[model samples]
Target: MGGESRIHNFGAGPAVLPLEVVTEVAESLPNMNDSGFGLMEVSHRSPAFQEVIDSAMGRMRRLLSVPDDYEVLFLQGGASTQFYMTALNLLSNGGAADFLVTGIWAKKALAEANRIGDGAAAWDDSSNGFKSVPGDGDYSVRDDAEYLHYTSNNTLFGTQFNHLPDSNGKPRVVDASSDICGAHLDVSKHDLIYAGAQKNLGPSGVTVVILSPWAASRGKEGLPTMLDYQTHISKGSMFNTPNTYGIFVLDKVLSWVERNGGLDGAIRRNQKKSGLIYDMLDGSDFWRPHAEVGSRSMMNVTWRLADEGLEDVFLSEAMDSGMGGLKGHRSVGGIRASLYNGCPVESVEALASFMAEFESRHG
Candidate 1:
């Protein structure tokens, strides 16, 4: 999966990782850091394993410019789990939480909030088919709400919040699962941020939670040990056997990101990658982007062919040309090229070239 035969991966989650990280993981699988045991066999309590987790956390803090007051936890259960965790921990006693329903994930989060306690959709774009973010006047913050929850990027709809919604002096909880680390984000702006490792950080089985001091202080005491953020925070994300190998790979990936100039570097590369396909789409009458111009995502760029009949042909030909995972989500029947941080510029170029040739053949 590391050479020419490797199709340019554009899958949404559990997506591409830097080849260097993959190689390093492969090399270390048999014996990590000169230890006799494989990485998977190493005890999480051992010093060797501790070093891996520490380095991963340290690199993440540096890369995101996370403040000293923030607690970074490498918890299990992806962002989906976070939907309930956030509500359980933060939603005030009998107080409703406010949610901006921009896409499917946000809707799920809102539903979880309703089940956990009281919740309401402060703003929703479902009527518009989730094609765009709510305009400035379309939404308002609830002063009495416990916290505001929003999905920073809509992977399914291919829409992103270029500018975060105004939380209006309230604590903002962001589910940045897909677009985390893809740009220089002001981590201090939000009270809490959660992302699944499979998208841009590393592999599945781990979730990264960045909690500001304020957010950490609000956790409910009676919650189960595993569900409590404070539990992970106190133990330094070592409450149980952690995702040892996933953290190892994540450390390697973060090192790669740091070597490449951290978040700023990622922003430049992603912009270029997404821009290539977008420019092609904008210029061509054959391909049509689903997201609105101002709301398009830099990570997952989705589009469709003019003739639905040719969709199968395009996917088949793209696969023959060493391209993979261009099919969109089932909810949206078209194409989605997820250009996560690990995807190289070369792969985007190859994809762009393929799109051109495809359009030429089908036009």
Candidate 2:
């Protein structure tokens, strides 16, 4: 605790939580609402917990400006479960789904859909080492496909679709786990949007699913009750003992987001944080960023040291200096600084200053 102020957390997911939220939760754990019991002791079916669950869903819809046509369900599994649920519900509708493989998550989603029914096209961009967005030109989609699936942000590769792909005539489905709440989305553009709450919303237990009524109607009939969107929507995301703690924290975070400026506010602050780091990468010869111009993610900034040999030394020193979780995914094998909503701008500025010092000493 002595050196806590000296450290900053930059982990991808299950990352930094707001100190205010943590403090409030810490205080409440002793005796919530003077009820002589903590939140952990409350019954999931009780009205107290139902209010918590309802408020979380309400905040989600308002903060994201989800349209009335959409149903927002906070499910138990992470976005990974959505990979299969999407296929089980949609792809099983007796038609294939078009998949645009932009990053690791998209590929995984497509693979799951393929297992259940049929994936119209692979759309492999692997030969490029996943550096750039897959070009939308000339690629054809099936007219009868259930839906077109894509991942909006590639967390591992540090690439983001700054512009959501124009779906042409197909229904758009997105895995937005990493970049969901970071900006204002034209929700009308996509029929379905799913994201795990761990990154920007709150914690790791809940996955947010927003589906247009028409898309929800397309879900296959007779699937397992839990995997069905209609089932979760009807239960108000309270079907089977929802993740109470996660939903409680998420509701608080949404309130925080609204007070701070909603999606536009998030976009402005994120740009500032990401810009600080991107500027340093561009100016410093010692640092090379993996994301191409116009395609960079404002959430996760992935970069490499000039020499791979220097990576370990840089990481070790960064850790010693009290900077946390700067290491990128092992698949990508570089440094990734994740600047989620909870991450203070001060953290990125401090990291940039350290990078500058490192470059000066090495040069």
Candidate 3:
């Protein structure tokens, strides 16, 4: 897809990607690393695929400044898996874990933790419609809590934590599915970090799991083989036939990030892209932006048309204008522009222009 064929996409997951990376992926589909096996058809145990996974892990370490003692594994399942796996592996026997319930995903994580042992909400913004994350003093961890879990960015509500939440010195577990490489994160501070690759990293099916030294060895025995983090860690994230094609695309995406100034660069661009939309939303009462000022996400900017019934019209016209994926999640029925690392500045400028024209005609 190119020029008129391509579009300014704002989908949440499996979002837009850099044209360069997409092109490279298409090129590699036929032959990858000069090997006889293609990217999708390559055996997980083959040498060519080994290089792909290795490069992905190494890039993740370098991009995030992950501590040397930490173990990085590209595992199956999505952030949903980490919700249960983290508690099963790290939560002490008969112990509880605390959660900051900022959105639907965090609430799901807490629910998953409860299935294993006890998961309590240290702080929750559900009462306020998931508009903001909590400050350190707003919540207290349980005395018996083994770890504190939080989602770095909430895609559905367009909220994000500007600073790391206070965990009361407990190990930090995060579901960073939406804003992993595009946002600021201190890998050394978190005991466990997991992200679904579909958003900022790559296509779906590949989930990056980073565990600290303690986390790697903290699991209780007798866990299922595939669900066990150590099982994958011991085999270098290849405990079974992994997501071969997904990992290869991930490596290519990371390579694109590396050449384009790494995580810092991605952050800068994400900020710029979201800022373009936020500025428009703030400048006019014609639009109602979600996620209070300081808690707004740099990845997803969501808002509603003040004029009733203009959302459908706006989406319809935006599609006609070559802009796609502006529809918000069902829970928040409005417009949502997900400006992930892959979304370029030009698309945002186009969206901003569209918003201006829509307001002029309808306001």
The estimated TM-scores of all candidates read: 0.98, 0.95, 0.98
* Predicted structure 3: clash tally: 0
Which has the greatest lDDT? 3
Candidate 1 TM-score over all chains jointly: 0.98
**What TM-score, to 2 decimals, does candidate 3 have?**
0.98
lDDT per residue, candidate 1, 1-363, as tens digits? Answer: 445567799999899998888888888989998987798899999999989999999999999999999999998889999998988888876787898998999999998888777888889989888888876567888788878899888999899999868876788999999988995568999889999999899999889999999889988768898988899999999989889989999899999999997889999999999999999999878988999999999999988899988988998898888889889998888899999999999999998988888888779
Task: Kindly report which residue stretches of model 2 are placed more than 4 angstroms away from their true locations once superposed.
Answer: 1-6, 33-35
Which one wins by lDDT: 2 or 3? 3
Number of backbone collisions per candidate: 0, 0, 0
| Lowest-sum lDDT 10-residue window in model 3 | 1-10
lDDT of 1: 0.89
lDDT, candidate 2, 212-253, per-residue tens:
877788766688898888888788777788888888888888
- Tens-place lDDT digits, model 3, residues 1-363: 464589999999989988988988888888887797777889988888888888899999999999999999999888888888988898876679999999999999999888888899999899898888888889999877888999999999999999988888889999999999999999999999999999999999999999999899888889988888889988998879999989888888888988998898999998888889999999889999988998999999988888648889999999999999989999888989999999999999999999999888888
What's the residue-level lDDT of 229 in candidate 3? 86
C-alpha lDDT of candidate 2 relative to the true structure: 0.83
Candidate ranking under TM-score, highest first, comes to 3, 1, 2
- Cα RMSDs, all models: 1.1, 1.8, 1.0
Ranking the candidates on lDDT from highest down gives 3, 1, 2
lDDT of each: 0.89, 0.83, 0.91
lDDT, candidate 2, residue 82?
Answer: 95
